[model samples]
Each structure stands twice: as C-alpha cells, then as structure tokens.
Target chain A: MKTAVSAPPARRPGGPAGRRRPGGGLSGRLGPLGVAAVAVAALLVLAALLAPVLAPYEPDIGSIVQRYLPPGPEHLLGTDQSGRDLLSRLLYGARTSLLGAAAVVVIAGVGGTLLALVATWFGGRVDAFIGRVLDLLFAFPNLLLAIIVVAVFGTGMAQATVALAMAYVPYTARVLRSVALRERRLPYVQAAELQGLSGVTVSGRHLLPNIAPQILTGAAINFGYAMIDLAALSFLGLGVQPPTADWGLMVSQGQDSLLQGYPQQSLLAGTCIVVAVAAFSVIGERLGGRAAGGRA
Target chain B: MNDDVKGTDGGVIGRAGGGSRRTAGAGGSGGSGAKGPGGAGGSGGNVIEISGLCKRFVTGRGSGRRTVDALDDVSLTVADGSCLAVVGESGSGKSTLARILVGLEAADAGEVVLAGRPVARRPRRAERRARARDIQMVFQDPNGSLNRRRTAGSAISEVLAAHHRVTGAEARRRVEELLEQVGLRPAHARSLPGELSGGQRQRVAIARALAAEPRVLVLDEAVAALDVSVQAQVLNLLSEIRRDRRLTYLFITHDLSVVRQVSEEVVVMRQGRIVERGSTTQVLDDPQHPYTRLLRDSAPRPGWRPVRAIGRDAAEVEA
Candidate 1:
C-alpha cells in the first residue's frame, strides 16, 4: 500500500466553525417578530433614559386623592397602590430594570472574556480546571446561585446586580471560550506565531476581534436573563427597596390591589418586563446568528 | 459546510505548530559552516539540510487503526538561495515534510539543520519563536493564511512589529513596500482578505511571509489553488522575490509540470519514501524508478492514453 502521508490535518467536517448560517440578517427570517421586538425594546430604553422628562409626575411621591385612580387623562397608566403615577413609575422602573441588567452583562462579559483568554492560553490542565469550574457554575440554577450571593452580600440593587452577574459569568466564559478556542488554532494565529509574536499579542489582536460579535451576542442574551432574574429578586424584596419605582418592586407592591380589581400597576409593570426581556432575547439571537453566519 | 475549505487550513496549521514535540533520529546536515547572524545575514550556502528524517502519525484516535509513515529516512539538501521541489501524489508526505521544515510538526525521528544551526527536537519557546523569525512559511491557501479581521496592510505591519520591532508609521511604510514587492498596490493594503480575490489574497500572503524577511520559506503547495495564468504569475513573483532577497525555498507540490518553472532539483516521494532525486530535467526526461516512469507516463498530454503493463492482467500467461 502507498505510504499515506497525513492527509491535511485540517479538514474538520463542516469546516472549523461548524456553524449553520442563519438565513439572513436580523430582519430576514425573524421578519416582523424581530423588528417589533427591537422597536419595543428601543422605546423602553428611551423611556427609561428620559424618565424625568417623559413622565407627567414624579415616580416616588404619591397623593392620597390620586391613589387607586383608574387610567385617566390627568394620571396616565393610573395610580399605583401608593397613588404614585403608574406611567412615571414604569418609566423609572425601566431605568432600574435595564440598567441593572446592563451592569450584569458588562460585569459578566469582562470576567468571562478574561477567563476565556486565560483558559485558552494555558490549555491542557489549566483549561480543564477552568472547564470544571464553569461546569460547577452551570450546575447551579442561575437564580438560586444569585439568591445565595444576595443572601451573603445582603439585599440591595448593587449586591443583587453583582450576584446575578457572577451567576452568569460561567455561561459567558463557556460560550466565549469555545469560540476563542476555535480561533486560537486557526492558521492566521499560526501565521502570527511564525512572526514570533507573543501569545497575548496574538490573542488580543486577532482572536479577540474575530470573536467580539459572539461575545456581544452572548452578553445580549445574558442581559435578558439578568433582567428576569433581577425582577424576580426584586419581587421577592431582595433587590430595590420599596418606593424605588422598580418594576419588580411595583409587582410586589401591586399584588394587594390585584385582589381589589385595580390591577393596572402590576399588569403594566408585568407587561413591561415581558416586552423588554423578549426584545433583548430576540436581539441576542439575531446578533449571534449574524456572527455565526460571518464566522462560517 | 459552504465555508469549510475556506477556513480550516489555518486551524490545522495551528494544531500542527503547537503539537507535542517528539525526539527523532539525528538528521542535522552538519558540515562546519559559520552560523552567520541568526536572523538575516548568511553565507548564502545550504539554507536547509534534512537527513534520515522520519515522521509517523497515529490516526483513528484510540481505535488503534494504523500508523501513517509520513516520512521515512528522507534525506535532502536545499542549496542557499536555491529552490528544490518535493513532488509526489497527495499522500506522498511532501506536505508533512514541509510542515516539519517550518516547525509546524514534530518529527518522530530525524535532524533538520537550518542555516548551519541544528534545530533541537524541542527547543525552548523563545528559541522556537526565534527560529520562526529565521524561517517562515507561505501556506497553500492565502485566504486561510491571513487574518480576516485585519486589513492587508495592518497584517504585514504586525509581522514587521513583532519581528523587527518597527512601529507606527515606519511599519506602515514598510508594509506598503512589501505589498508592492508582491505585485499588490498600496491601496490593496487597506482591503481585508474577504474583499480581495483569490489571486490578490495569495499575493497578500506572500507579502506577509516576506515581511519576516527570513532566510528560508517553506511553500506547501503555495500556488496550487490559483488559476493556470495566476499560477504562472505567482511562480514568477516567487522567483523574482528569491532573486531580490536571496531566499531559499522548499517548494512542495504534486504537480510536476510546474516543478521546472520554480525548482532546480526535484525529489519524488512515494509512500513516505524518496524514490527519485536529481535535477528537474534529468528526472523528468530520463526516469529510473518504475514509479517515476509511471508518473512521467501519467502527466496529462493531448492524445495520451493509459498503456498496458507488460505481461500483466489476463496476459500474465504470456510471461
């Protein structure tokens, strides 16, 4: 038999990335669902930012006469149990909800990115160790671990936000790690090595940028999850203190009014949470799909 | 699946480069020669010497299927500033040999002496990288070789920064010069690999390789993927670059037709072994080995057909 030289050591089936390209851009297969999700999410963010200006009344102060008022011309979205303006509170709650989620995403993203880079750099035993740690993190329910962190750190916006961020770190690290791992062995990296470039330089210069979109997509998805988790934390009174105009806090406060048939506050905040989370989730999927399409 | 071929070569080269190092038989081409400065200057003598080089790869992973003898007791020399083509069928181990030469793979046994210094079976990391500065590679796929995220000019500038420590505008200026040398316009530097055509991308790869300004280049089927016309153009560019830089080349390919265009000597490998070695003209015109004869016969020519072997098949009774 002819001595078969090692055929191309490459030639992994489905090529290196092994991705199924999303049909088209965010607007393609996602169609109207994606567009609506984006539009609603953008409006929520805008309202959240312009809360002081957009809202007709202050989110914190409430009037006895205005309390329990149904949706009316003077008080939009009606009044919460405290008689605070519902529109103002929901707008303000957007700040609390989205900002907290954004914080979690940023913290998780940076931590995960650093860990992924380190794991890929060390590889072998170090890589395995990191993989195991991430697995342990994944083993616990994100909310459960986050609650535990809040329990230890004591309940508050900062603590809950950080707790949730920590809970999501393993996920971001695992995802970014895999993408970075694939790129670490690519020929361009090897080409850089042939120039005698340092591992850190190669990672920072080449591997990181190629995988940036993947990280962004991951963070986007994490943002949605973080938002939901923070809301639950706040609903359980472990997040924003009462009278903070937080959506989760509003939900917890509005429960009693639901029994009395004045469900405007709880219903509005619940709708806001759902719309915001869904929008972020869809956006995350779209970003991830685009990155995968370009990658393959 | 659609982009598989476009991307995997670099991934493979990555694993091959950083894979475990293995000890092999002593194969250094040692004849006392001054070790001119490691990076640039040289005696313009034998830039590469391989002796008793053997590489065996175990495939099928844990199933213990078979061990592929990629290179077996291979010995060859590439004169300083000369081009030597290692020609064979796809499985003949020519690519493996190229990989070993460029420090992309470990040889189970053998010695490779580059520029009068014997390369260790496994050198220290710094030394390995230093060796990279001395010897570089131009891969088979130009698209696979370059970083898609980086502009063509920045890619070259990076090699300049990494090896020569040329920074800022100096590196930018040098990148343009290298681009021009590879027959690419200065504007081509601003474009990414995806925006460039295959031929232009190949030129970018060459420019990037030359950025290191190494003494030796291991081109593993560098021009095989190009069009016939582009192949001729790249071949000429390679020769011109060699003339200007005094670079030695280990030009590897399965195509015999282009061997004469790029190489002075040819080594024909069959089944992990060197079956024939001599001048390109001598080996192509007057072959000795039966396999060589078969290969010569097989070259596609108009009106050529497969000739029956003597006393073979159903005619065996005639013997």
Candidate 2:
C-alpha cells in the first residue's frame, strides 16, 4: 500500500484563533448585564443564608399594635399587615424561596439530563418511548400539575416542589435530548464505541461532557422558572403555608392591605420576586448565547 | 459466496506469516508489485468475509417515507495482511459496508465473519467489545473523530485502557510511543483536537485505531478530508503501520487514485451493488464494465477535460 512519500512538516503551528485560550475568559464572555445578574443572584443567596443573623426581629413574631407601619427608622420597607418587619420577613423568605427553587432545579435538571443521555445513547424504540412519555408530561401546565400534587399530597413546600420538578422534567429533557442526539451522531461517540468502551462509558464521558453547556443553560433557565412557579403556588395558598416566611405567602398576606390604600407589602414582595427571576433569566440567556457561539 | 476464489494465492499467506515489517525501499512497491489478477483472491485464512449483506434506511415519516437500500447483497473477502479498496460514488454502499463490518450498523440481512468468527447482528456488550478488538474504523473527518474536549493523549489512552489493562504511567508511556510511531511529538499529545492541524488530527485518529491492535482496519474515506500533500503522508504512514502489524484493511473510498495507490484488489460499486472486481492493474488499465470505465475516466488527471459523455453514461449506468 505504499505510495510516493510527500511527508509534510509534523506541526503547522496553530492559527491565531486556535492558540487564543479555551474559554476566552469568564469576564470577557459575560457582558455588563450578565455581571449584574450574577451579582444579584449571589447577593440573594448570601441574604438567604444569613437571614437568621441579618433580620432584627423574628419573621413570624409580629405585634398587632405596630401593624401597617410605613417605612421609617423603626421598620425599613414598612411593616406587613401582621406588623412583621418586612425586611426581616423578606430576608427569611429568600431562604425558603431560593432553596425550594434550587431543589426543583436540581431534581428536574439531573433527572432530565440522565433521561436524555439514555435516550440518545440507546436510540430507536427506546428513544421513541422516552420521548412519548416526556411529551405526555409536557402536555400538562406546570401550575396545574403542582395544584394536583398539592391536592393529592396536601399543601407543603416539599410536595409542591416535587410536583413542579416533575412538570419541569419534560422541558429540560426535550431540549437536552435534541442536543444530545446531535452530539451522539458525531464521530467522536462512534470512535469511543469502536474503542471497546461500554455504552455507559461513552454516554457519560463523551456524550455528557459535549452537551454540558446546554445542561447548564437549561438548569439556569429552569431555576428562574422554578422560583416563579413555586412562588405562584405559595401565593395561591398551596405552598410554604401561612406564617412561614415565603415571598409568595407575603404577597397573598399583603393583599388586604393593598385594598386599604397601603400597597407597600404586596408591591415590595412582588418586586423582589421579579428581580430574582429577571436576574436568573439574564444569566441563562448569556450562557445560552455563549453556548451557541461556541458551537458556531 | 465465492468459495471458489478462496486459497488462490499462497504467496500472500507466506508473506503474512513471515510478519516482516516493510523497509522504506520495499514499501514503495510492496503489495501491488509483480502480482497477477489471480493473486488478488483471498488466501485460505481470510481476515474479513462478508456475504449477502443488505441495509435499508427508511427516511422521513408516514407518507413521505422512502426506503433506500444502502447495501444490496454485497459480498467480498479480504486476505490476511492485504488491503481491499472499495471504490464508489457517495451513497453507493461502500461506507455502509464498512459501518456494518465494524458493528456500527446492523445489516438487515447478512453475515460478517472477522478472523473466522461470525459477528452477531444484535451484539451484547461483551460481544461488541470482542468484535472491536478484531476490527476498528478510522472515519473520514479527522476533526470529528476525536472529542474536542479531550486531549489527544486522553483519546489514545482511553482506547488502550478499554482494550488493555494498562493504566496511569504505563498508559501514558504507551500513548507517547503511539504518537511517535505516527510521527507526532510527545507534546502534541497534550493538545486538543481543535489545536491540531487536519493532518495532525488524522494521525492521532490513526494512532488511536492502532491502539486496538486489531486484525482489520476499516478506513472509511479516512484520508479524503486531508490536503493532497497531507493525504500522501497519511497514506504512507498507514502503509507502514499495516506492514508492521500485518493488518488487513477495508479501504472504502471514492478516489480512484487513492485506490490505485494503496490497494492490491479494487471493487467498483454503484448504487449499492458491486459492478466489477479485479486486481487494481487490470481494472484501472482495461475496464470491463461500463460503470468501471466511467469511474476511471471521471477521475481528474493531467489535461483531462470534463465532458458531456459522463452525464449521459451515468444515466445509462443507472438504467
């Protein structure tokens, strides 16, 4: 099988684009908005963790005499209808809200990604079966699914969070499955298979790492959605329960005060929810854009 | 399937048994030199034998679905330590044949015998790994063959770790040796596929394939993606490796020039069927089949002009 030898140079010295760094540095990739979103997210997490030390008054212990007090030296951001310090309740509420959303994201993201990897690795009927099941789950609205779980299991943060996660699985799974399917077809996966690596090894190492950016982006976006969904369930009196400092319950509790020309409690709680959700969304979008760019 | 053709060339078996590596001078005219058409037939110990192979792909859905035969009853054999080039246009079943042989795709109907053992269509994990130990494939696109996220050393080491019991320092040493054998520096092993040139990546892929130490190497358009100069270099490297390892090769390609350069026997395929098969010299010099003649004439050469005759002849071949 010999031919005329025309041995070229061993190394060609990679082009400028090739030599320039793997990730292009984190700060450079994240623009101003992404930075702000990350900052907001970090601050919210810190505030949640330090709620016990940060709050001047206990979130559940409020006086009826000091009810509906306006924002002043005594109570920043005013007092709720129960005369609870809104600042203290908001801080403690961040703990329940963020942790609950995190639980939903972790469960849904991990479960969905594993399902996607399995479907993609063992394609054909297996993929079709998993896809159909996910489609069935996809048909239900998230809140309705949460409501059914709450109705069946009785209202609590754990029940509501689990139900919301089930509802979210289809979203993450569908997106990840499509991407994983594309990654599965690449020659790298075939090379690994031809090397005698087991299907599990190929999927875990070659398949999963290639689609990790998509997983991160999906998880980030789902975190925001999970937060909003859980808060909505709490607002409807199906999650976190009364007297447990939660953003959604705070919104619902301030409703009566809203009608009496004192909208501080409801508006402030709603703004916190909006800010947190928006921050997560911005970060997710940036990561998504970067993932796309990396592919291109 | 073609039992009459078996054991026709005793010389090939003798050379294979000798297990002598090719020197630089001998390699220039090694396999294809001084051999007649009869010498192209397989020896008694065939490394790869496929018979009545068929693969059909159903694309689209419902009313739009159409079944395309990727391989239609293709049967061939490769003598141990010989390279058999399967040449055709795209969608002519050459690649499908390679894929099926390497156990990437299951044939709708047929049998594949590698190293005298029948391959299972629906192979279990152990069966699949056993088959991989006998045959490995090098894909067309070098960039796509290795994981972009992994370093070249890791890719090679993974294959070694999977097939052999080597680990840590032992594995790393073997990986470096494989790199040097492919004419790459040790430092190149640390670089990602993205950082390597097209030719460098192809060499890494070839190195990884060698890590399996298989009896057969199926190169599916392996060097087609490289530049002309780089393609020649890789082809030489492959020849040297095959000589050293006594590896049988199923060289699937559309390039007639490449077929002439690397293969002793050539099989002409068109639309999922083998049209002609013979020693490379006889087929290329004096083609018997009209499709073979068309393929020969269509290849670009010095002062060769594109003509209207090709299009009309292609239609006739289709008929």
Candidate 3:
C-alpha cells in the first residue's frame, strides 16, 4: 500500500481537457466520408467565389445573335434561350444557393438551439407552450410557407431566406429539445446542480456542447432541404426573381427552351441542386455520427 | 503458484493479517522509492460531522405514493483521519446516507456539517463547488460511476481542473502523477474506461477523488464489486491513503466483517435509521441491537456449523 502511493508517474503527457490528437476520435472513423464531403463543399465554395473571374461571358450579357448556341469552347455548357452563357449562370447560381442555405442554417441553428434550451431548461409551462407553437408551425409545408412569405413580402433574397429560416426553426428546435431533455437527466447534470452551476452554465457548457453535433447534423439536413425548397420557389418565379442567375430561375428558363431542343438549362440547374444537397448531407451524416460516438 | 489467489479464503480478519504481511514486502520492493501523495502517517477534528440528518425520496409521480424515508433522523460523526464503516442491508439506507452527506442528494431535513460547515443552505455556485472539493466521493460500481465517453486520464483530470485551478502543462503533470499514484502506468491515461478491468477503474476513480485533496472521502460500497483478493488490496490502499493523508472516510458497506476490519467505529442502519453505533469491537463483539446481532449471525463464517439443525442429542443440550 505504501509503495502504491509512491508509484504515480511524475510526468503526465496529456492536457487537462483530454487533449485530442488533431482530428482524432470519430474523425478517424469518418476519414473517407469527411474528406469527400469537404472536398465537394470546398469545390462549390471556390467555384462560387471565382465565378466573375472564371466566367467567359457575363451571365446577363445576352445576345440575340448568339442565342441558343450549342455547347462549344466559348459557351461550355452552351447558352440559355436568351444566349446568356449557361456555365456562367450555373457558377454564379451556386453563390445564391450556398449563401441561402448558409443563412438558413445559421438562423435556424442559433435561434432554435436557444429557444429549445430555454424551453427545456424552464420546462413545465414554457416547454408546453413552445411544443404547441412548434406543432402549429410544423403544420405548414416549408416550401408553401416560403412561397406565401415570398408572395406576401414581395420576393427578394432576404425575404426568401427569412421565410426559409422560420420554416426550418421548428425542426431544429424539436431536435435540440430531444437531446437537451436526455442530457438533463445525466448524473453529471445533478452533480453540476449540486455544485451550484447556474442553469445557464449547466445548459450552455454541458448541454450545448453535447447537443451541438445533433444540431449541426440537423442544420446540414435542413440546409439541403432549404436549398431544394429555394430552388423550387425560384423556378416558380417566387424566389430571387429574374436576372439573379438562380438555379430555380434557370430551371424555369430551361422549361421554355425544352421544345427548342436545348436541355442544358434544366440539366445544369438540376445538377447544381443535387450536388449541393449531397455535399451537405455527407457532412451532416459524419457530424451526427461523431456526436453519437460521444467524441469531442 | 499464484500467491494471492492461493490465499483468498481468509476471512476479513485473515485478510487483515495477510495485509500486514504485504506491508513487510513493501520494504524490499521500493526500488524507485519516493513518498507518494497519500504518504503513510498523520491523524488529527471531526472531518465529517452530521447531526439529525433526514432525507426522503418521493416515489412514482403524482399517485400520492409513499415517500421512501431513505434516511430517517440519522446522526453520525466521523473522526478526522479515521475510517468509519456504515453497514446495512440493501434499502437499509446505508448508500442513501452516503449520497446525502456528499451533497449528491439533498437531505429533506437536518444538518451535514463537513470539516465544520453546513452542507445544506445551498451555498453560492463557486462556494458549493469549493465545498465539494473538500469532500470527494467514490461510488460502488466502477463501470457505472465513471464517464465512459472520456479517457481515464481525462476523467481523472476533470476533477483536478474543476477544483484545483490548474491548467495546461501543470494540470497534465498532476494528472499523470494521479494516474501513477493510483498504481496505473501513466500511459494508461489514453485508454477509455471500457478497456480497464473492474479493479483498475476503481483505482482511477479513487485517483480522481484524491486529485481534489479532499478532507473527507465517502466510499459508497467502494470495493463491493471486486473479487475478494482485489477487494483486500483496495481496502489496504484506502487505509494507507487515509493514514497518510489524514483523510476522514465514511465507508458505506453491507459486509459486517469488512467493516470490522477497516473501521474504528461502526454504525449499523436498518429501515432508514441507524440502529447501532459504537466502536468496532463494541458493535461486532457485543451487538446490543437485535438487528446488528442478526446481521452478524447471518454473515458467512468459513468453518462454522448451524446450531439449529443438529441431532436431538445435541439439540437437547441447547434446551
């Protein structure tokens, strides 16, 4: 027994907070999937950022003479019915789609995370009230909800983004609340309470960190949903409006040229939407997996 | 032959006798000899003082169900630097009292004065945490008490970081020291709780409690799950730590024989109330409470025959 006391090694190698080797834990398991997702998202972001410098012709600089040009060196993906370069429009359209999805993710993640924490933390009447309110919001289909807001607020990127965020908030809040309620019952929560950590500290430090992966996963899934919904609305002329080079608007233009044998407009726009959603879905799945694995 | 396993049948008294023999071995094996944290001699105040403590747990929500009187009007004090065993059968409230005294569960009524201050009254957040730092607790099941998500090193370091105000390199050094102190190699820090055996995990748990430099340690059936031999070793380490650190301990257990060996004083609880309290000899050798007698009589003895089932000739002598 006396020897046991003296046996402790003098030099410990790790940090106090469980120093994870850079990208250790779940990242190790998620290696291939994470790399694939990052590579795709990075490509999209870079393409969107360099659209102006990379595009051969301005998306809106249409010419009647060159209109409906077939795929060639000068018009890589060919031109829409108006002779605007389809490649340029698709590249710039990424900026709008990615940005709209990002805004929706941020607004919904932060707003819904806070709301659900408050609901779960206070519980009783507060939780019941939020539950009912979320149920009411969930009743509306998100695209229809966004269309009504776009229809009501007169159609702009800001209004469409706001409408999409509101639609996604209920989903974010519901997921967050489920995780928070589960964490609230852990032994450490009671330990924290006994230690007198305030409700804020308990929720913020313990609850939020534990639930972030789930929320982020939900955000990723919602981002995909939001991107598709935004495009669909734009296709219906209720999003981004004309001359904005949105994928949905391109799809609408493509519909007009379908009889003329030019399928690039819809095909390129449809491909962009599919790729963006897939990028976010991959990232979301990896994050949610890590969260469930309980690795920081 | 494996020496310890060969010697496993020893009763509590035999284990203590065998433990003394091991201490003699320590003299020969101190190759990298250094004084460990729970250095071997000190004694001194009531490190834990409880008076009229009562805790009740409400059962089965909203059916007007009866509340479990987990602890009923229990008053006990542990001397500084001594192990006081609390023994009782399951649901007899032994663990409940330990939990309440450590502030894991609040007492429905009464006072738990630890190292001189009341454990009730809801101290400010920082102060309560500070108070908790002085009185650390270790639970029965090593697997359940520890957080499976964290590595053993991080698990130990968390308590140090929370209460010691140490950070970065200093905290890391201390955590390694703690890991080493608990008889595990420092390299074991990276291993998750799942990889460790039952005994090793308990050692880590003890190391975590030790990190706070607690004045009073509460062991809620701390060695109950270990094999008999490992249990003896842990008990010895605990006693060694208590003596060296001048630490006070409320050792909760259901085993009367184990209690008799570790504690100077023992408190036997029954139906949420303490039925007997006295020196180990006074309680074990001459139990006044009928419950304590039953507990003592029921405890398995290696070479004893039942008095009730003898032949008529032997039975007639009893009559």
Docking verdict class for candidate 2 = acceptable
- The DockQ for candidate 3, computed on C-alphas, is 0.13
Q: What is the C-alpha lDDT profile of model 1 across A166-230, one tens digit per residue? A: 99999999989998898877777778865656678888998898879889889888888888889
Model 3 TM-score (B-chain only): 0.79
lDDT of 3 by residue, B227-318 (tens): 98989988888887765566667899988878976887677887787777666887788887767776786677988555453345333422
TM-score of 1: 0.81
The residue-level lDDT of candidate 3 at B131 comes to 75
Top model by lDDT, which number? 2
> Which candidate should be chosen as best, given TM-score against the real structure?
2
Q: Alpha carbon lDDT of residue A128, candidate 2? A: 96
Error at A156, model 3, angstroms = 2.7
- Per-residue lDDT for A69-101 in model 3, tens only? 989988888988888999999988889988988
Q: Which model scores highest in DockQ?
A: 2
Regions of candidate 3 where Cα sits further than 4 Å from its true position: A1-42, A65-73, A112-154, A180-212, A233-239, A252-263, A286-296, B1-74, B87-96, B140-180, B184-201, B224-231, B253-261, B266-319
**Count of backbone collisions within predicted model 3:** 2
The candidates, ranked best first by DockQ, are 2, 1, 3
lDDT of 1: 0.77
Model 3: residue A157 alpha-carbon error in angstroms: 2.3
Worst 10 residues of 1 chain B by lDDT: B2-11
